[model samples]
Target chain A: MPAHIKNWSRDDLLLVAIDEGSSVSATFTQNTFCAAPVTVAKEHIASGSVRALLVNAGNANAATGERGIADARACCRAVAASLGIESSEVLPFSTGVIGEHLPLQRLLDAIPQAADRLCSNGWGQAAKAIMTTDTAPKTATRELEVAGERVRIVGIAKGAGMIQPNMATMLAYVATDAAIEQSLLNDWVQEAVAASFNRISVDGDTSTNDACVLIATGASAPPSANPQDDDYARLKAAIIAVHIELAQAIVRDGEGATKFVTVQVTGAASSEEALKVAFEVGESPLVKTALYASDPNWGRLVMAVGNAGIEGLDTGGVNIYLDDVQVVEAGGRAAGYREELGEAVFSKPEFTITVDLGRGDSREHIWTCDFSHDYVTINAEYRT
Target chain B: MPAHIKNWSRDDLLLVAIDEGSSVSATFTQNTFCAAPVTVAKEHIASGSVRALLVNAGNANAATGERGIADARACCRAVAASLGIESSEVLPFSTGVIGEHLPLQRLLDAIPQAADRLCSNGWGQAAKAIMTTDTAPKTATRELEVAGERVRIVGIAKGAGMIQPNMATMLAYVATDAAIEQSLLNDWVQEAVAASFNRISVDGDTSTNDACVLIATGASAPPSANPQDDDYARLKAAIIAVHIELAQAIVRDGEGATKFVTVQVTGAASSEEALKVAFEVGESPLVKTALYASDPNWGRLVMAVGNAGIEGLDTGGVNIYLDDVQVVEAGGRAAGYREELGEAVFSKPEFTITVDLGRGDSREHIWTCDFSHDYVTINAEYRT
Candidate 1:
């Protein structure tokens, strides 16, 4: 079973029925190669009101030139006409193959059916419909009691390949029934994504389309507290919780992946260095293969960390741990180390590998999975 | 039936011999992750003159700390002591597997027995011994008439993976019976490599240990005219021809490769931009898959060129030709372009992909191969 529920897994499209009091915001890919759908979504989200969201599977509608833009707009108009709202009030999302024109006829025919079945409660279905090559839909929801009134935040995301966040490839939608301004929601979503989605990588390739949207429907009672108060903390926590879960799911479902790994770099001179160190370790094929073989080869790990282009990293001060087992310390393999210890540590389906630079307090984390034969097979025969 | 000759196809280590009058020049990987053998070879090559070269397969004595350094020096010393030459004159090269101590005892035991069988002219034998996972040994030889004396330049290289040239991966040794100054030879070899070996990539990974050495044994008389004169053109041509052939052999032997591809980018704003555009197109997975499946997907070619970070690349000015058939022009699919033309173009065992930026006079050429399922299988299962 998926982490949340079944209703979402069965739905073909997302329903249009969140409460009227919601404010919507989004951040899209900044690449010059931005896709047509991304161009459309950015324009719609700028209005700060999203009455309903219409997303579909099986086509990404990217790289199809002007026709792609026209098709995406047409889908939104159809959804709005069904909901009896202005076309600008609906947001559309797509995930799947790139450089193909949208099947506008099929999508337009499905929107009325989708909006008619739209339910505020079907976050799970919304997640599934936006999936492409994703082994499972990712959904996370957290309820927080802020100022003695319950507030809930739900998030869903889909990605597996072409996933290395120069903003990583994927769509993430987080909705809440709270009274919040569009500006605040936008800032929070970007901040959360920067900390979570932006930190992970599966492949180094960046996609033409990438987006994260957050909606606040004002279904929950308004807090008496200001945006700077503990009420904001509760809201931020829910958003971050969902973002982290969705990001982890992307890693778990990483193409040709069998083991989930986390690389943490601490005691760095700056957050940037920490991030560089973490990503270098996360993306190394040697390190990934070691993870697959369940071999805690710290030498390869040290080699990767050393190559990260970080200045002034005292190699001697580096200490590496695999799932709490101290495998390397002080620029060398730990004494009394044995392959059996490494093998035991790697035997887990999920584990953490930590590197302490012993420099300062700055730190960063990267989540990824091992590269297996399946990744190659998928890519080699993809076009065929 | 090999590109060069029949007698050159097969040999064992015992049949190879070192040239006594050899003047050797070599360049090693510049990465701080330099392997132990790289360090030792740098010292040997820096010693002014080297006569004999000793190499062992199945262990790349790299990243093994002090022990690796000691082992590499020991191998050279063992060969020197047996050959009755100073240890500094014996250059050692190693390949295969990194970050582990070499089994020097086993190698030491094998060298003397192999040395007894060395013959003065066994270029074919030297080529075969250096191979790792290569289906065939690579050797390119050219004979040119200079000043009425025939000079033979035979070059050989070995590589299948971890091949991106910071210098050169796999060992390439070219021995010529041409009498030339070490200074001029060094300049000639470096310039030739920049145009040949440096223009290809098997994978983006640069190995820890990589060395390419050229040893010129001044046995033939000097040219009757100054080398700066056009009279030496035939000799220079021979060197360049051998370099190109040896470099292409590495590409032909690229791991899991089924098709060899040449990407030509022309009419760019600068040479750097042309190279950037060429490499981007050559390295793209989408383009590689199209090559693998023999699919005429010109959109992927345009996408790669645009993503190259090259500025002012008027998409409309872009033109892509798969062989003689124009698939994309005027920034879109060519009017009346046919898929059958593309298929026919790709069906050839070797073909050129030309991208015209129509921006400036700059151009570049890059060689690559299709990424197949075997590439993943070979790499993923290599260690196991």
Candidate 2:
């Protein structure tokens, strides 16, 4: 089933099959240039039903005019006809070069072979089939008891380059065997993704093909539809854990990323301000490069904070820490702060930066990675 | 004369003198954390009479609490005492690490020495002294006839990193021998900067120490102070030309930049939209890297345009070109486009990218540079 769609292959075409009559809820990229398949998927998902997904990796099929939409529709039709389902029941997805057409005939030809190899253990294979420039497959699973019934949740994601999802990642799929109401599943999918996938970044390029789909097969005893139920809360937590795990893995595997970084903004006036501060630090190239060199340059961090454009920001009341060692206290260098302490913390492969604005109790955190020369090399040579 | 009070040096103190009684107009960084010197310069320039500028390199004297203001005032005081002028008549500038106090004693000690070296040709040395990480001093001169009188305009600037001037560059000084009213000088300075320095970017990190000062010393027969005077237009044009030359030099010397790029956005609903779209493409790491690699990846350009947050942007109406070769027409790849054509254009040391929205008649342009591995290397190693 995992064929030429493998990473770095000449033709990154992918085909996969899933159970019929599955309950699915999904999220897609908010990028205005969303791909043709994203447009089709949004329209199809609005029907409140989905059975299968036909996805390819070589062409994103975006900005390709009316012809692109026709090709996506044709792909869905072929998949649905072969699987004995309605065309709208089969959602289509594409990722890779934008503004290119899909090789429909070749992709359709491989669907039969892919369907024959589908099995419960196809999660790992499917993960590989959907990858574009990703170096490794990203998958996470959790098993828990819901109302005394064994419930299982599995999630897979593929994003190594055009990251910084405004909604969800480039491509992600989560499936569960616990029965849940369609409406509740939709709400949980949105909330869970907002809490996890929306709180991480890699390159800050929101991909046009981003989509996250969650499916329920109802193969096991399920919890109540409402979160008021004890089992519902537990299942939600497990699902959230899977989402976070997959989200974090995307950052870890971020193209050319050398170090994992977590930025937490605390004591802001609101959650929005907290996230604004967090992104100001996460998306700053100066700060990222300094982190790459392990330079422990706290001034760059302060510069990023200043550029965050927070209104009425009391610079004098701000506090910044590299891990446990305080670097900036009350907006300036702490009285006894030493450069060596910061150097020691930043030299580590993973560290936390806590910025407390001391205005309110709101807090936000984001996971990111250091920018290195490899990042430029990878993106620069991607087309060549 | 400019002196080395560099950020990392043991001392980065500096001082310079100007003719007594100059009509001065100035602009400072809009960064909320504007440096202590910037705040004092803003107040001093409001008086329309400035005689000296005391600058340091090592510490930006920003985010340094009330003591930073006192330190800046002290430097100005010492300069004023030596020149027999009021402290308010002296402006201060500092560019280096933010949140660090100036070496008040060393800076005060150097004022007399700097004043002693003030010659008409001190422009060259002054440019070198104000540099923090700049590899070369940027200077431009223009001589023109205004109302049958010779008018000369000279400009010098220094900015290597953190060179995105939201208002003006890190530091730019333009002096003219044309007599003009205080109000006219102020209005013309704003207009000239908007057309020049404000349209260039390096890393998009608006520095805390940005300042541009324009002075008219009446050293030569001058044009009429009234804008309605025909000779005033020619003089303004010469001054604006000098500003652009000096501003473009900053981008040419952008930290580790290997190629210069000019991004032009046209046919938009408004000038604001044009600037948004232009910056979206100019600041994109993906686009910059592709340019660095000489890759004709127009899809990345399209992605940037889409992310510009333009309301009701019809992707089908957008057009893009690399140099003179049309890449995207009517939102998709131009019929005659070839990868080799883009590669050939991008392989050059400089080029232009023109984006046409085809929505209205508004247009805007920005000067930028390709992001390269050396950019990461330079910033990463700066602190070390």
Best by TM-score: 2
Tens digits of lDDT, candidate 2, A42-96: 9999986688887787678887777788988988888787777788987888888
Tens-place lDDT digits, model 2, residues B152-269: 8888888877867577667889898888777888898899899888888887788878888888887785545557877778788888999999899999998889989999999999
Give DockQ for candidates 1 onward, in order.
0.27, 0.65
List candidate 2 segments past 4 Å from native. A2-21, B1-14, B221-223
| Residue range A1-384, candidate 1, lDDT tens digits | 111111234344454454576777777764445666777887887775677776665555655666778988998889788888777777777665555566677666767766666554677766776676688989998988777788888888988876776663578888877777767876888888887788777765566677887778777776633677877776787788788889899989988889989999888988998988898789876677668767676666876776675666666687888877887766556665677887888889999999898899999888989876677666545545
- For residue B303, model 1's alpha carbon misses the true position, in angstroms, by 4.9
User: TM-score, each model?
Assistant: 0.88, 0.96
* Candidate 1 local Cα displacement, residue A4, angstroms: 27
- Model 1: colliding residue pairs: A8-A124, A8-A125, A15-A118, A22-A216, A22-A217, A165-A168
TM-score of 2: 0.96
lDDT accuracy of residue B242 in candidate 1: 87
In model 2, the clashing pairs are B5-B12, B5-B13, B5-B58, B6-B12, B6-B58, B7-B58
The CA lDDT at B158 in model 1 is 84
Model 1 TM:
0.88
